[model samples]
Target: MEQNLSLEQIQNFKGKYPRQLWYLFFSEMWERFCFYGMRGMLVVFMVGQLGMNDRIANLQYGATQAWVYAFTFIGGLFADKILGLRKSLFWGGILMIIGSVILSIDPKNFFFIGIGFTIVGTGFFKPNISSMVGQLYQDGDPRRDAGFSFFYMGVNLGALIGGYICIAVAEGSMWQSLVPEHLRWNVGFGFAAIVMIISLLTFTQTQKKLGTIGISPLLEIESSKRKRMETLTYVGSLLIIPVIIVMVANTVYTDYFMMFIGPASILYLLYEMKNFSAAENKKLFAALIFIIFSIFFWAFFEQSGGSLSLFAVNNLNNTILGVKLSPNGVNNSANSFFVIGFAALVGLVWLWMAKRKIEPNTVIKFGLAFLFLAAGFWIFYYTKFFAGADGRTSLGLFTFGWFIITFGELCLSPIGMSAMTKLSPLKTQAVIMGMWFLASAYGQYFAGLLGANIAEASEHATNLEKLNVYADGYKQLGIYALIAGVILILISPLVKKLMQEVK
Candidate 1:
């Protein structure tokens, strides 16, 4: 007689998590440390050190972020089908190390060179690590969402350290007597490189514990057909480089990325739709809707790195505990701090509500995210009327605004990952996860466009004047967010029905 699985066994089942996940987690953590640490400094460095205008710095930052998120989808695809997660991850670490070293060189044109390598490295690293987390669990595993939560915590942990700790070290004065000015920033990059090396070493040492996970793809497929297909795809993709270059160059005239990703995403969805049952179809629809709305939320929220960063610099006083702070880095830290502190709270609330059978569904969480986001920006706008002669606003106001935005991110970001893992059927799990990430990529792109818009009018404006312009833009975004939030709240009940109690 065949054995049937019982509820107790299913609920209590422990997936084998060896040392590998920890290694990957730490590796990812350090990589983020490098990425966010650099990011925190980039705006300040560009404007302060390089004498670049606010508009240029904002544009550059947005473009870099857009490429980073966009490549997550590419990384996911290659890992799932070609290089396998392990090799891709290892190579990614190597590339990032190279990038960091190049950045440390601090050449006149080091920005472009370092960013180029970082983008390439991120393309190999980002998606594969997330996929490996899923690989740790089995099909129909309820724990999958929880596992991703654990993984995302690792991401936030790195961000927390990078945003505050690393930045503090690089820019801090406690060690200033011991370190020279020219070498200070270089020390930061060096530290990042060392961390990458440590992560790479850690992963290699823990390989045996990982079991057969993240192995190379060559082991699975036959040599002949797979080789031909890989070569063809690579060549075809390369051949389209000129076309992509032209599109990127014309980003102003056309929403080239959306024109491509939107139709492509729709086609892919339709193809996948046929394979799903009615219940699964409903879940997919719900996810799709959430993804669209989430993009709008992110476009506004992501200003933290662009307009908000600038605001913290030009418009807000940065003195804290008698130590002068970098405006850009200090405000960015708020989001990460909230993620670390509130992730557990959010998780607990979900569990507590689930037990009472009164948990607001995923859609509700997203709607609330929009409300918080809009409220934060509106609060930011309120501070503008009190601007000082130097155009500096109260630091307390910026802090309070960041606190509100943190709650918004906590609701939307972690929950989106949870919903994606839960609602996706087993066979298409990785693809769906990739698509989830793809939406984020689109959001990052839109964020760039938005930042570019605010900065454009202020091209010749002083930093303070440009900040006022950005604040006005924030007020408008606040209105847009409010409208979007209400719409989501109205349809949330219907979306909740489609969820089928996956939570």
Candidate 2:
């Protein structure tokens, strides 16, 4: 029999980590498998099967991902106010399963419709789980960063497996004997749905360990009124599905939506700030600085899913160490692989540095992340110098670049998740985490525009021409990322001052 674990008891855990993190870790792992599976398939499917141009596919990928993260704000709000973390996650998982199943039915025809479901579902699913992870540790727990690091591993582990398998399945690299070439797209999508069900079930069986941590925020409300509020939220969520379909299908609508959401979120945050102390507000502002800079960070780093995917298709040889492999699969899964390998070691490095009292603060870590990001992009640019006559570059160098960026990602992303929880007021933690992802939404939006501009090689352009064009863009991005790192380091004192004792 299961019991309701109190928040106090969960947070009272003073060990290296609480056992609950494992359950959340596994549940989140499966959820990410579903997510990355779909993500790995998206732009590739659009280009190869849907007959879309690189620019259009990039724009569509951006819109789709932007909507996915943007809705996290809405989902976080709902979970904070009504459904609570667990329910929001459960509802979101159901929607994602539905979306993947829909895509499996007829990938090209139902692509946008399926994506619409996924965007809204991910909105509901993404932020709340991170918030719950935050709840496991008491404020000022030294282990919080490592806990998040372990959780981050779950995310990448899923990405590594699904990222490869889903793309391989869709492209007939796997299941070739069973799934016909044309129908592989369907199986690829269907595979995501099957795993999503497992994700939801994993949470269902283990969520009791979370106890009251993710329970409804309306526990104090009258029962009937709570029911009414919950009902309205469910109905409202259903209604947004079609609207999302429309927005995701048209890049122009995506532009409009992004323009509106950013200001609206800021205004809402301003409104919410009235409820907190001056000190908390300062911390919030500090989190805002990180959030603001993160948009640019992602703009450069997120090329993996957008332009880089297409680049892999057009410009890279397909093999690793003379073993036959897919460049696209390598592009899709490489960062996740590196992160999985490095996340824990990186986390432990922080612990060791802290013990020696030589730890770089979060802001410095972020700055260093950008420096590595710059180096990775520069390497990406340099790869073109070694291209063959057919214009394919060294797969070894491309993968090595991802290895460098993985350090950047390790420095920033898991740390950013930790920073949001630390900086935010307890009541608004979900909102802040949502804001963090919303920054990624903007990053994805601009990543699309940047990728589209870089993919200017004409249909008749030679492979070498295409490689040169993309490499030039990457060189520019490298310079920008390097500049961003320097500026962040210069400004770190101010942000660190605001963060005060949080780090």
Candidate 3:
């Protein structure tokens, strides 16, 4: 039987007030404001401003995103063990703000610097804040999932707003007259930087209130040996990065980042062995399994920003509500649109299930996520029916596909985060979370590889042939995803058993 938490525990779990959550909400909102805004524009900038092929641009874009998530694991570790959550959050936010400013300069050097800073900032900010959300609820608190669901909604809300707003500012009609084509990229990044500052300020104001509720997880640790090993791992990874860059110079492959992932994985494995226990090891192994599957999920889903974005620009009819829409505006907004509309509903569904003792286990949901995503891609694949006379596709078909993809994301992303927190023991949470992002990094790399194949093939193929390639790939991916989902479902009962009441 489940033990009901005491009233004191309930009050304690509220963590200062609902307002504190709101403060974090807005802070995250702005951070995502920068992230999604930049993301919406990144591929477009790569292809248009830099004059790279779609294949090269998508590959680079995927690498950047992979690094963003991969580094978050490292950042999460720093916050967990060294910097403490608040300081880490502050430093990360500040660095991100600075990165945003530099990116607004729109220099080629600034691109590298922006990626670096954004990576550092995400490292410091992402997991710590996510951890804080869990801290808001006491052990065995029933409301923990509900609270995370609420918080996850904030994430989608931010993504939704940032997606549309950034596209509007970046792709506006006024830009033709008010700004030069080359310099216009700065406008979106500048806005993102300003919003990031506001987010930082919001967090600063709420620190005292939040401080009373939960202490930093790093406070009680006294293991210098663990610290030393972590330092060594990071330094080693840093030293090897140049070698990887050199290799990238020589390789014919588009994904230069995979070389980095190889070395980074080695460093991480060595680090995990230091002072780690058997249970933690099991959890890490399981987490790695989930991470592996997530790569396929994200690779396909992320095409929305790259291949899909370009597809929308080139192929989709963008007339909506009797107003001519920018292709960027339509394409970039799809995930955000579904996220904003359905996030709350998905949360409510989970809450209702939890109430009835029927919430699907995380692994099972992961399977469902894969199938749903595959189904969405299948929708696009079959929608050859909607391809227009001018070789365009219906905006409606793409919209429906995005909705299905978002449903898949809803099943995976938040639930995955929650699993990362709950399944792992206290000591390795950040590194494990980093591993989660690493999977995404790999997925992004794969997405880039796939996009490159599409782009390269397009050079030889007619438009109809190109569309057929996309359709065929989509169909294959759909079948692959269906198999993954079915396998996960078959394994679900056992995976749930492995979780051992972690739900």
Worst 10 residues of 1 by lDDT: 1-10
Candidate 3: the clashing residue pairs are 66-441, 73-434, 75-123
**Candidate 1 lDDT tens digits, 3-61:** 23332332344552323457667877777777777777676666767787777677666
TM-scores, all candidates, are 0.85, 0.98, 0.86
How well does candidate 3 score on lDDT at residue 357? 96
Better of 1 and 3 by lDDT: 3
Q: How many residue pairs clash in all the candidates, one count each?
A: 0, 0, 3
Ranking by TM-score: 2, 3, 1
Name the candidate that leads on lDDT.
2
Off by over 4 Å in 2: 457-459
Best model number under TM-score = 2
Q: Per-residue lDDT of 1-503 in model 3, one digit per residue for the tens?
A: 11243324434744423445676777788788788888888878777776877777777777667666766766776666666667768877887887889888873556766656776677667777777665555555555555666677777677777776676666663346776666677887787789889889988887666653334454456677556654664465445444433433232332445666656774776576666676656656666667778888888888877777766666677765566666676677777777777876787788788889998878988999998998898987876667766666677776788789888988998778777767666666666666777777777777777776776766566556666667677787788888888998898776766666666
Among all windows of 10 consecutive residues in model 2, the one with the lowest summed lDDT is 1-10
> Model 3 reaches what TM-score against the true structure?
0.86
Indicate the residue-level lDDT of 330 in model 1: 66
Better of 2 and 3 by TM-score: 2
Whichever of 1 and 3 has more TM-score, that candidate is 3
In angstroms, the error of model 1 at 85 is 2.8
